[model samples]
Target: MTATTTPLLGQMMDVPLLVSSLIAHAARHHGNAQIVSRRIEGDVHRYTYRECEVRSKQLAQALIALGVEPGERIGTLAWNGYRHLEAYFGVTGFGAVCHTINPRLFPEQIAWIVNHADDRYILFDITFAALVDALAPQCPQVRGWIALCDESHRPAMRTPVLCYETLLAAQNGEFDWPLLDERSASNLCYTSGTTGNPKGALYTHRSAVLHAYGASLPDAMGLSARDAMLPVVPMFHVNAWGLPHAGPLNGTKLVLPGKDLDGKSLYELMEAEGVTCSAGVPTVWLGLLAYMREAGVKFSTLKRTVIGGSACPPAMLRTYEDDYGVQVIHAWGMTEMSPLGTLAKLNWEQAQRPPEAQRALLEKQGRVIFGVDMKIVGDDGRELPWDGVAFGDLYVRGPWIIDRYFRQESGTPLVDGWFPTGDVATIDPDGFLHITDRSKDVIKSGGEWISSIELENIAVAHPAIAEAACIACAHPRWTERPLIVAVKKPGAQVTREELLAFFEGKVVKWWLPDDAVFVDELPHTATGKLQKLKLREQFRHHVLPSALEVGDKCPLEPLDSDKGAASGATANTKSAATRG
Candidate 1:
């Protein structure tokens, strides 16, 4: 018998989760909160949320007056500043898409992205005037250009440009944000185009808002109103790792460092603004640590920092946690994961473990946050157990994960409703994840897969080595072998033999690097990750003469560490570094 029951309607209101609501909430509740930015004009710009909202409305009006329609793409080529943040809200709030352009990309890539998106207007920073001028001719679909500065700062350009201040000043009436569908696209961010041409990630208001909430939880970024937050990450990439939205949501005091992310500038800004928490890549912290060591400086108010883009070296983590009173939160994500997937924070049970034991968990990428589910799949697409030992391809599924890349007729990025993250990782029984390497970057030696990231991490721990990247170089018999491309520390010396021997007992005897070649500098992406593609191409025919001499067995005769062809490390780094 069929049962019949009454379907009662709930009393809750169906309010759309629009980004404009976030700004409006901040304006009403946290109006007095400060938003300080080091402007491109070499001056510090300061304003409150109340003032920011008013200006955003005016900018929204300006955008509308310029013939921007709902769902239109409004591009921005600016750094992390007040104006960029304004464009973020104003463009989306006015029912248009804000495509934050990464100027670091190649000229052709930039032109392709703008023309492909069919951007109506582009707001460029004064520093990028020449770049925009050069690109405008290639992108005929762009209606016009707006300089993100006062009339005085606008450069004499070949194309007609309007000033940001002038445009906002012309609009006097208060503009109301449109009732936008939460599922509609709100922002567009393209990948870095490492393998093929970059593809756009279309983010909707619902996904963006839900992602903000997920990232702000205590288990995640844990931003609070009392905390003075500084996002050193660029605003163009993954919405600056979603810090901008999280800030206003939590009423966290924000400090935006313009373009100069050097040690001196970052240190001064952090101290001046009392930055309690910061986020950036491992390379960024390397520079800051070097500067602090040289200048004998200590962090006054800076307490916690989130390190991502690449794995954080164990030595760097210890320096921030043990040497200085700063907490290093290791995180992992891709531009596709709304940029934040996992954060390495110890749970109560794990925190009670001894420091040595705790380091083991700290070294792995953090566990997945709620609202995000992850599983590792073998080559056959079958799910693997969370046994710490078996590393497999990582796949994730969630509300925010991309269903399909923008404008691609190519099949969806998901396999059976799960997004394959192109990462080789191991998940422990406790849900901790360790990202071994990118699928393309993993070295396939013989029949086994060797993690390049793991090898590089072990190599950089050597005191004489400043920076390192591991790439799969072609070999005679093994098909392929691991080659470490290294940068020597200043005033230090170490031979290839010594560098290879340094890996003794730290990894499997067979897993040791076949060769160590020193280079002046390693190529890096704009987001601070090692560009292994370039290294692979550069060393495609690299011959491991030294390792070949030893045959299939380990080499005998470890060279002394004090002597080498190049420079660095006046002192023994073995003791100074975190010895595995």
Candidate 2:
């Protein structure tokens, strides 16, 4: 007798999880909720979900009239405002792929990405009219240029442009959104292309829906109808970390700041909108903290924030948690995993621990979420133990993880079914992950690898230090040593000896940088990580002090510091993991 298969007793409905459904749910169930945007025209734009639904239909009709077909890529070169949000729903709902181009990229990169995507219609804000004109010749595949403005603000450009309002006005009142398969691609976002040519991360409707659902859970971002959300992260960068979709799914009010992500602008918008939660990188928060300190203001409404894109300094974390009574969740992800692999929200048991212990736990990248799984592997492809001491290359597998780059560029970026995240990290027994350094950025000094990230994090905790980065520089004996590039707070100064003294006990003597050099400002990637490759090149032939050799007295006498006393705790404390 053959083995029999079992089936469910009740028949279940199989409605596809399309991007259109998110907006539809908002329009029908939470029709009156507000989606506010600070427009580029120096005015706040407000619209209800019901209004957004109707206008999105009109824009879809416009796309159809312009001969856009399902699966074709549509480009958006605009800021984080109402128009961009409309473009998102319009392009994706009409069955076309929405490709959001980062305007902050170099012209060469911008042109290359738009051309590579083979975008049919490039919808751009008025601010980018000049850029579009410059890029029009290179991107000949763009059939039409739709300026995201009215007839009054229309720009004269080399390519014939259509006014956004006029195009929408000409379209009929409504459009019938097709029932696309859940697996169809809905959004396309390319990486910053720091090392090589940028690769696109094509997200499907199914993956995006699941990502939003996972992000909205109580343990993840905890988005709900009662919270007002401000996503300072750009819409072009990883789809603003998926907040746009998550907001609608949970009926959360959204406040989108256009091109004005500066300190004053963000603070005003957050205060006026009563924003309860926000997400951005640490650098952005640094500016906000400075502005708040000078202006003598506090975040009256913001209760929590999520910091990602790079490691968050412990001092910055402390300011929000200690001074303002706001919770900080350290998130770690890349563009590959729908940008949310792990979020460092405290568990109940961990929450019961002391503040110092909690800070130590929060320093590491948080535990993995439900949809994602991770593992550490050594050179021999053997799985490493999660004893928190043995650091290895991090690999991740998940429903939303990319199996291959778009257009098969650098085809199949997976190793035995897992994507290799280039960062070196350790997994604690309790499942927390501490990212030590990027494989490229790790410094090898006298046969020992020093984590540049860990050093930089410790350096920035000093009261006078504003920003810091560690780069590997040439040395006579060691071959490579950690070199520090630090920026001081305005009107503040500190000696190199004083700064290095704080790191004496942080790690072994060799781990500290040989010298500290102050700079006005450090370079940053488009997505806000420090541009270390350029720094490495600048100091490649740097000469070290004559006296310092492979083995010498610790740079400076040990001084008291929180990170110094608790240094190497993550690596030294080894315990067994409860999970396999």
Candidate 3:
């Protein structure tokens, strides 16, 4: 029988899910688990979960003694180290938000972000001492600056700053985590600001906790106590894609690589620490692979790596699995969704398919886990079917997703309750997401869209090509055409015609780049993403030799190796094409 009265709630204790609980659990259950870090001071620091808990509590007491109030923002300009990890929990345990600032950003942007967040106290590593001094004048609202180092190593700066160790030593590890509303803001991470000024994504305690749980599942990161994980991604970037939280939640040993993300450094650390799983962007993996190839080395314990931030090249995937016996987990996400929406893990049916078929599915971003719901929409705002062909704008909605920017007060960026991801993509029937291109980076040639990512992937597949970027060059006839900007391997040589001919059968004829140009290197964002925006600007006035007049019918055909060869087209030398 249907009752007219309100439904009675279950008689379970309503426990608030908080970030502090994750670390507390780790300390209680896995107190001996190690947290290793290569410090910026050219040394290594090791601590256990039990010691980490004690120090984190001491740090909270120090923050309280310094008059930091609940809901206030505490900024950290440090790399991934024990001190930074302490701040991650310490600042949040007492309800203050931990604002991680990307040190790789321009100084002006760092100052602007600090001012925008109105940080109370900035705790920074010694490496950024000069940067902190330079930013002090621009950030008048900041209460004080604390160096994340011992007193002996503190640098001489124009502005006075406190020592993190000195402060923590004075506090006893008797402080208790305050009971905070689960919805209270826990961390703040600003976007990379590739377009305009960076907007902050203030993550709440509840969202962070939920994201940690979701990301640690078997189908996601597959994290557990048995693993020693290294997050090559910086802690400043979306809390290192929520690894800092998930690591503690599952009692996974964490190895923090500080300031030396070079191939040799990472290789040694992983081997010495017995790291089984790692995560980072494609550019970082490229460096590691190049080093491995040069040194003829192999991982002893590393079993997998999660590649995100940008698309992982299919060639790179094959190299990892075939050459090195390491599985590459392709992931996709943004800062707004706590940076982990989908992780590439094959399902039972997909795993049972042929290896080639499985590889094809693995090439695409995996299906959503339990928390996230995604859909693709056409230009008319109509939902598109997941047929793997109808590409459209991608949208997502989930509990951990952002409802609005940190301080944005006006209209919402959400379209009909879903956050537009600013990505052009298609979803297969089995729910794999194939991101064609970023909305702004997609090439519009003759009213047709060309996937720059696909073109770049094929270009990088060439053995001689070290990296590649595909950008739109203005074409008088078709409005725009594709151009390949490539970087060749050191001492390797290939002609422009030879490179252009490599794409003959891989894609449609028209999708072939109109021209190829060799450069020393392509520009990258602070987070190791291809800076196509800068490339487009640099080549905006570049003239394509194959461009036709307004009324001319452009030939859409594969390159004829002999006919398409430009004079002195050797890739050993940089392109002599005229710049604007």
Q: How do the residues 1-580 of candidate 3 rate in per-residue lDDT, one tens digit apiece?
A: 7767887789999888899998899999999999999987898999999899999999999999999999999999988899999999999999999999999999999999999999999999999989998999999999999998888898999989999999999998997787889999999999999887999999999999999999999999999999999999999999999999999999999999999999999999999999999999999999999999999999999999999999999999999999999999999999999989988889898999999999999999888988899999998999999999999999999989998998896868899999999999999999999999999888888999999999999999999999999988777777778999899999989888889999999999999998888887888989999998767655655667777545445433322221232223332222433121
Q: Rate the local accuracy (lDDT) of all candidates.
A: 0.85, 0.85, 0.91
User: Which is superior by lDDT, 2 or 3?
Assistant: 3
TM-score of each: 0.93, 0.93, 0.95
Question: Over 4 Å off in model 1, which ranges?
Answer: 1-9, 546-580
Q: Give the winner by lDDT: 1 or 3.
A: 3
Q: Which residue pairs show collisions in model 2?
A: none
Global fold similarity of model 2 (TM-score): 0.93
At residue 67, candidate 3 shows an lDDT of: 97
Each model's backbone clash number: 5, 0, 0
* Tens-place lDDT digits, model 2, residues 1-580: 7676985577789899988889889989999999999987889999988788788889999888888999999999888887888887889997999999988888899999989999999999898988988899988899999998899888878779989999988877577678999999999999988886899999999999999998997878999999999998889899899998998899999999999888899999999999999999898999888898889889899999999999999889988889887898899999988889888878899999998998898888889989999999987989999999998899999988889889996569799999999989999988999999988788878777899989998899988889999987666567677877788899887887888887889888879788777777888988898998666544443445532554543332211221243244332101211000
- Per-residue lDDT tens digits for candidate 1, residues 1-580, read 7676967789999999988888888888999999999999998999988788888898999988888899999999988899999988999997899998899988899999999888999999898988988998999999999999998888998988989999999987387888899999999999888766888998999888888898898888899888899998899888999898888888888899988999989999999999999999998899999899899999999888999989998878887899989989899988788888998989999999998989889888898888799999999889999999898999998988898898885779888999999999999988999999998778888879898988998898999888999987666466667888888889888888889899899989778888878887888886788987766655543556644664734322211211231123232222222222
lDDT of 3 at 104: 91
Candidate 1 colliding pairs? 489-568, 491-568, 492-567, 492-568, 492-569
Give the best candidate by TM-score: 3
